[model samples]
Target chain A: MLERVRIVLVNTSLPANIGAAARAMKTMGLAQMVLVAPKIFPSPEADTLSSGATDILAQARVVSSLDEAIAGCRLVIGTSARSRHIPWPLLNPRAAAAQAWAELPVGEVALVFGREDRGLTNDELHKCHYHVHIPTNPDFSSLNLAAAVQVLAYEMRMRSLEDDQVEAPFWGVDWDIDAAPAEDIERLFVHLEQVLVKVDFLDPENPRQLMTRLRRLFLRSRLDTVELNVLRGFLTAIEKSSKQ
Target chain B: MLERVRIVLVNTSLPANIGAAARAMKTMGLAQMVLVAPKIFPSPEADTLSSGATDILAQARVVSSLDEAIAGCRLVIGTSARSRHIPWPLLNPRAAAAQAWAELPVGEVALVFGREDRGLTNDELHKCHYHVHIPTNPDFSSLNLAAAVQVLAYEMRMRSLEDDQVEAPFWGVDWDIDAAPAEDIERLFVHLEQVLVKVDFLDPENPRQLMTRLRRLFLRSRLDTVELNVLRGFLTAIEKSSKQ
Candidate 1:
């Protein structure tokens, strides 16, 4: 996943900021940097600002345009401080990373950052499928170019590190055991509803509101198979007691 | 909350970075700046780099030691890339901000960032009650001192802006209505144990084991008054049933 991420800087003004961006990217485990018509590349100022991240700049790919920069990438995310006039699906940095991670196949995923002064032009922004906005103070939303890259890269790296398999510990056992699948849980809900109606705990007529509320409560609990069985057992006991 | 945050730079080498730090703080609504053993103060480079934030530097306090800088602050958060031997409570930026917001008084909340090369010494880290480690790439963790300050300041500002009175809504109306005062909650736990014994859920003989498990479960739930009332009511019902 890390290898697939390609960070592209578009028309960067300051060489120092470009260097800092590379440093930021490297710090967050992101190596691939593509500069689009930087004002001054391979400058001493850039090397000085990059500190230990000179290797990233040494290996960086230089391009002319945004289109040329992200040509091969399957997933393209444009970074923006403010919303544009044209409609584009907007996502926060974390959500954008999640979207990118989900969609990224064998192809590269390009995370495009705009210029230091006036961000990406609408034409450049239009080329990307989604725009990511870092939430900031309304009064002073001036995030440095490198800081912007750092935030996005950090989110992507953190998400990548999360375990793919969803397993939680419960009662000194992995909750995956005896876990009723989703279909089973849905079937049990139907069964419980039938029993509730028979017991008159749920009104058969005009039951929509009450049933919805009950469903929401159960959904919020996120019960696995063992927990579902425990709940069903309790409901069964209640049903028997009602009959008695 | 913003007023309470004191931004402390320890052994800062560059005057320009100090200026940048001031600008970053001001942008994030953090006012106080404390410098500890800086190489140069009142340097022209600092004023030049400060941009429009020179006022923050002008008002900044210079202290002889890190200890002196944070003497008044109850919550001291040290920022570092590396982990320390003393094992101060390690927190991510958000968690550290939450802890600071909750624990620190309205007077001073110290956020300490170390030198550019080697970060805070183990002894310096020990002085802080909590350590905030910005999630950076392990391979190259060389974040600019000012950038590090900016990230933490931004997080703190964003968190502080969230509606202070609004309890997380998931806890529901019962939480709002029948919520126990902190003192009442503590008392209720003691009373609950006494009732547990009467109900024989707590064994009169060989009591420690069952009581420990029950206590653990109750603590995990963090029962408010509404929850406490529900449990107590159920226990009363059981006692009545036993009597019958």
Candidate 2:
């Protein structure tokens, strides 16, 4: 089960964090590592920092884009700090592990981590099936990248060890049983936000947290592929009606 | 409740860790901080790391020993990843937070974190009523001292949000009970341990956890000054019996 899970790091600036993350992953018995456009790798610093878990770092696969990083994975979970911009399908680390690995019996899973300074771009985050938030002291919520990986990795390893396969309660009964990938959801957000602006229901300038709050409500509903289209269709209807 | 909880770091080697710990505590709405025999303090590095939490560092109390650090505290909980030598009454961060804050309604409480490398010594662990163990990947279980503080501090903040006191099990029976200060309690430990040693019930040389176990048992009783005196009187009676 652990073998099927991959750790994806996005635009990592520090070689030390890569090594530290590798060490953390190996300690949790997780070995698959994919780096998305890392600034440096195969460097002495990462080697020195990996301590005894240098094997994981040595085998880490570096990719140019997040899409390339999780190419084979059936499920991709992104670790986020609950960014102010928009809320996506969010789960605490434990629930996320449960959700991701429930598919472990089927195929590979990917856990994506962001850069040290700026986290994943909204466009990049749109690729994830879910976002895992580590409960942190909000004052110092910006945890070191390795620590964040360690937390999620630990939960993944623990979730694998437990014999019971308890699925998280479904968000809602919807037309689409298959959850839409991040791209569909992002498109819906774009279409809906645009329609809202066109209908004079929302101001494009000084947008505030209006879109963010709407994102939370929609994300909580876990909009499926069919559901996403339905929402976009409704937005189109609002645009047409407002034009008349 | 938040005011009564004090964070104590014993023999901290790094000033940056101290500053980072302060930042963590402040983010969680915790203010009381005590440093016991820190190797280097009043450090610019600490101020830099603390960022906006420098005021907490400026107002922090420095003490010579753990006893002085927790001088007036009625309860002391030491955060250790479970020292190899002995099994102390262990509570995970969540339970530790609940236990520590439960005393805030009456008297001060201390949360101690030891040197970054080794955690609390066995003797120091004995002084605490409970030990909080933050669960981490066992293979690379070493968490940065500040991160550990951040984890526990976060739990405390969350615990404070939960509105449930009626479910807490009662501690003891006493009237208008103001808990004895840590100084008085330390004195009582000294007197009782001495009397027990004299009575041959405890061997001071290689004492093991005889006194440590006794400390836990009494600490749990939430001894008020009168209760402390009564326990001392009972110990004195034993000393007299042995001499007779």
Residue A113 miss distance in model 2 (angstroms): 2.1
Q: Given candidate 2, what's the lDDT at residue B116?
A: 79
lDDT of 1: 0.71
True lDDT of residue B71, candidate 2: 59
Q: What is the interface RMSD of each candidate, in Å?
A: 23.6, 27.0
Please report, in order, the local distance difference test score of every candidate based on alpha carbons.
Answer: 0.71, 0.71
Question: Proportion of native contacts found in each model?
Answer: 0.17, 0.05
DockQ, 0 to 1 scale, candidate 2 = 0.03
In the order shown, the candidates' DockQ scores are: 0.07, 0.03
Write the residue-wise lDDT of candidate 2 on B94-188 in tens digits.
66777666556655778899997888886566556556776555666756677677667766766786653222223332336554543455567
Model 2 / residue A17 / CA error / Å:
3.0
Task: Flag regions of model 1 displaced more than 4 Å.
Answer: A104-107, A162-244, B104-107, B161-244
| List of clashing residue pairs for candidate 1 | A27-B137, A180-A225
TM-score of each: 0.63, 0.58
